[model samples]
Target: MKTVEVQNLIEIGLDGAEVEVSDPQGTGDHFAATVVWSGFEDMSLIQQHQAVYKTLGDYLTREIHALQLKTSAK
Candidate 1:
């Protein structure tokens, strides 16, 4: 995926939060994203993970094959 797309995915996923995604796989299907956000402060780990997956929409059902996520609160 293009850099902008990755950026947008982060933006949308994190609710316009600032984040950077790394695609070590060099494939759009698999990606590692570092999400830094204040909104995550009091959220549960499952909630945090859900937030990211939520942004992917139907991608989880069909589209992207896999995603390895790394999240943090900033």
Candidate 2:
């Protein structure tokens, strides 16, 4: 999930942002994603995170187990 999410972030984030998604559990059951993006240019920090969260959708609601998000813009 981390790898896939990272790839998704990179795809959407373009060269504008640096992204990191981690799962300390090593079981892929629980996860945390930290994203830094310049694509946030005109958007507020919260909005930027909202964009990322929109991507994950039902995955977290159902099959993802547990997930947390930290997002920023630079």
Candidate 3:
């Protein structure tokens, strides 16, 4: 998927989230996302990643072959 589509999916799933998606090798299936959301304030690193994964759902395993996620509290 395109980075813009990934960004939109994340933004829709996480209210007030800031999402940045990139293709590391110019391969659309491999992506890296930087997600910032206030909801992560009290969550663990794992939880933060889980939230992102949950939002992306099947896209992560189906459309996206690999994802490098950087998550933070905003």
| Candidate 3 TM-score, true structure as reference | 0.95
List, residue by residue over 14-71, the lDDT tens digit for candidate 3: 9999899999888899999999999999999999999988888999878989889999
Clashes of 2: 0
RMSD of 1: 1.9
Compared with the true structure, the alpha-carbon lDDT of candidate 3 equals: 0.92
Q: By the TM-score metric, which is better: model 2 or model 3? A: 3
Clashing pairs in 2: none
lDDT of 1 by residue, 1-74 (tens): 54456658668767757677666777766666777777878989888878878877886667567767766687
Residue 49 in model 1: shift from native, Å? 0.7
lDDT of 2 by residue, 1-74 (tens): 55566447454745655667677788676877777776777887678767776666676666568667676667
Q: Which run of 10 residues does model 2 get worst, by summed lDDT?
A: 6-15
Which numbered prediction scores highest in lDDT against the true structure? Answer: 3
TM-score of each: 0.77, 0.64, 0.95
Q: Sorted on lDDT, highest at the top, how do the candidates line up?
A: 3, 1, 2
* lDDT of candidate 2 at residue 59, scale 0 to 100: 64
Model 1: how far residue 32 lies from native, Å: 0.7
Indicate whether candidate 1 or candidate 2 has the larger lDDT: 1
